[model samples]
Target: MAYLKERHLFPGGNTSKGFYSFYKYILSQEDGNRILCMKGSPGSGKSYFMKKIGAHFAAKGYTIEYHHCSSDNNSLDAVVIKELKLAILDGTAPHMVDPIHPGAVDEVLNMGEALDMDALFLNKKEIMEVQKKISKTFERAYRYFAAAKDIHDDWSSLNAESISTDKISTVTESLKEEIFHTQKSGYGADRHLFATAFTPNGIVTFAEDLVFGFENKFILNGGPGFGKTEIFKKIGSTAQRKGYFVEYMHDPLIPERIEHLLIPELSTCVLTTNEISQTSFTGKVYNIEDFCKADVIAANKEEVAYCSKIFYDLIEKGLSLITDAHTIHDELETFYISAMNFDVANDIFDKVVKKFEKFE
Candidate 1:
């Protein structure tokens, strides 16, 4: 069966203060998969090359996971062919990845070798200027995020009394028991994904895909700062201990918050969301919002609304800054594109694909 799924490794905007990467988890030892890390500058055709590889395997009935770039949703960061136990990813700045088991299970593909370095060096001054502009715009974006985080923290603190940690724990314990029945020996690997991403359509999520292979699913409905992450952590940890590979999908706005957990061994999933309606869920609906104290919500209603407005407004500003950074990045790409030899790059990529055909 050919299956395709897309997920983000990092979120766009100020959600993460520094570079956030899931490369370690993707290239973990447990999977024993070969990683072909591509090294190249922007517009060197890394993304295009990976996509061609993905399409080739997908046509041969392999399940493919497309890891998308957070900054430019149109581009891909990596592609995985799970059936072949293989992956090829972009190994560059902000998400640079190196071979853990070089000459064994990992190797590097230098796409930059196909570039005319002499041509690129001629435009060094212009390229450096654009790079500096990109850095400045990204800094502005993070500042907006820092400010938004402050407002969100205040809102959480104000509503702390309304949320019951004990209740959250109890619910989690019950879920653990219900799912696992009896704990198993050995630990399974953990994988990370971003359910929500900053795309051209604004913030978007692939939440529905989380329940694809599961017979039983739980859709959690609640607001932020309500111990949702704690609940997900407990369940995911429990499943890992019970020897089930778990895919943890995190929230884009709040990096610490896990929005979904897929335990493939048990064919089950637990997803948290406020935007998706319960009626649309294929499985059970768990409305954790009911646990909130109505009286506390009533008393803090005005402050909550004001804080929320401020947080969202700041987030919008941060996103706009990111958009500006991408604009500068696009201009920077022109120099690299001019230096790259597409004909040579395409030939190299085809050879890479032919090597994978041995697996068939």
Candidate 2:
């Protein structure tokens, strides 16, 4: 689709085409995702273009939703913007619609009105200068995938006797590189951390160590109850309060629950189940390389490597590693109570205790 330059999109040449080209560039992405930040004079057509693009996507069988960034005086961040986009695309409940963050709402509502927005209208010379800046700033940082008319068509092309591990690795690496580049543009000197809720159990403690231990990595592990998620929320909220940008990666396959609690804020407290193909601290089976990426709440690199190897062994053996640890702990407690079984239980527990005790 042709990009709607300011002069072309509006009647009479007044506003510059700076944001328009940027919007067009976003639309050109393989995922059909775009987050346009409109800044112009009062009558410069911010709302007009917003409506136009939203309608265009809807007509193309894409989901569309409009958000008033100034409503409720919230700060607009990438997390909120992306969630809004996803909510529109997914047709989520109306209650799921989020207000601007309390911290940002006042500023947005006030600044939004004071700016002419229409003041961006410019002559051809100004438009040219703006376009030049846009071209220079936005390099082709993304690699485009072959577009498919439909999802089925895309899957059909991938039908093979067997999927090659090498191809999957290549695609994963390329996607990670793309994400790294995109984040580099938005991230600041201050690093942010996010976690699930803190259960009174050691889950909360584990999460804190993981976050404080890793520089840029995230640690995600599902627990049997809501405790873990609760701690994650507090950590996420704390990070946001400390001026850190956070983005939650929601589990796609599970129904939304406590994870939704942090949604309106756009903090990274939401979590989705890990992919079996990816390395995750959760039960999902992962390769050694995937395990290496985990922030295992360990003190040193040696512990990290050991825990990863242990996780791989457990996954390969089809053992529930987490459950096994808990079960063994319970057994240890029970053995201590039963005078008769103490002999056997003590022997079995001694070896396992020795393994994890070093971490303490």
Candidate 3:
């Protein structure tokens, strides 16, 4: 990867050396995949560069999906919540980046109507005046989402116009209460156990403990506040230290990195929560089918194979995988193992499983 430091990935590609560095670094990865963010003033070639890169990737037979945020559509959060609701309602998870995630297309279509209602009945100045009002209204819209889960619990009593705003608030509060109120649903007892540890100074600096290599694929499971997020950040920092390119996706939308990394047949990895699985149809929420299906599938294949090897034994013997949180998260675990030699793989595998038996 250091070999890329002096080379440029683009000529006349853009107006900045950052773009050149980005191109080369992304190319240095095993799959030469990356997520690149192009942010600049409106006329500073952001769009032009995106188009150029998109086309370049397309010419190489890599898939591309693009979405531009603007005033008319639902905001990113609204999209995530809306699609999450739809998935639960329909019992089919949608990709995080779906149009449905942004509330029905009707909502987007209705925006024109809503804006017209604001405009035709009011002056241009009035519309501008309500801009803040609209923003404030959305802040409360998330409340409606919280309440919506049980809006029809008493279906026979339902009437859209008959229900008062206060009633909505009451119902929303009831639903919100369930998140913290534990119940013996068998889920709590059967829940997966995961462990995580971090130094107070933080692993963001990449100074946390390092496993020389990894040996299997694993899932990192823990409830909120148990330090799962910190573990993820540490993995990113560590991978970067190993001289491998890294891309982080914290967004609900299809990551922009995929566009840049896989263009012209780029291979890339996407990391996020399992909740992401709910929104992506064709395994993606937004219509970014290309990212989900592109050749060189995203996942830890070696660890997956290794895990599959011992899975049945563990199930029959009632054993578990014992290792640090980072060694088990399916994504990082595979990469760590892949970077190791054969002897290291065997030792780590045995150590991880032996410790897993004593994790309780």
The candidate that achieves the highest TM-score relative to the unseen native structure: 1
Put down candidate 1 lDDT per residue, 1-360, tens digits, no spaces.
Answer: 112343334322236464456666654555745788899999898888888888888888787777777777778888888777788878898777888789678899999889999999999999999999988987787787778777887887777668877777777877887788665678977888776665433565666664555677877776666777888998898888888788887766566767788887777888775531122556776767577787887898899889989988987787788788888899999999988898999889888887777766
What is the TM-score (0 to 1) of candidate 2?
0.20
Cα lDDT, all candidates? 0.74, 0.26, 0.23
Return model 1's CA RMSD, one decimal: 2.8
Candidate 1 residue pairs in backbone clash: none
> lDDT value for candidate 3?
0.23
Which run of 10 residues does model 3 get worst, by summed lDDT?
Answer: 188-197
Q: Rank the candidates by lDDT, best first.
A: 1, 2, 3
Model 3 clashing-pair count: 30
Candidate scoring better on lDDT of 1 and 3: 1
> Could you tell me how far off, in angstroms, the CA of residue 26 lies in candidate 1 after the best superposition?
2.0
Top-lDDT candidate index: 1
lDDT of 3 at 200: 14
TM-score of each: 0.91, 0.20, 0.25
Query: Residue 327 lDDT in model 3?
Result: 21
The deviation in Å at residue 168 for candidate 3 is 41
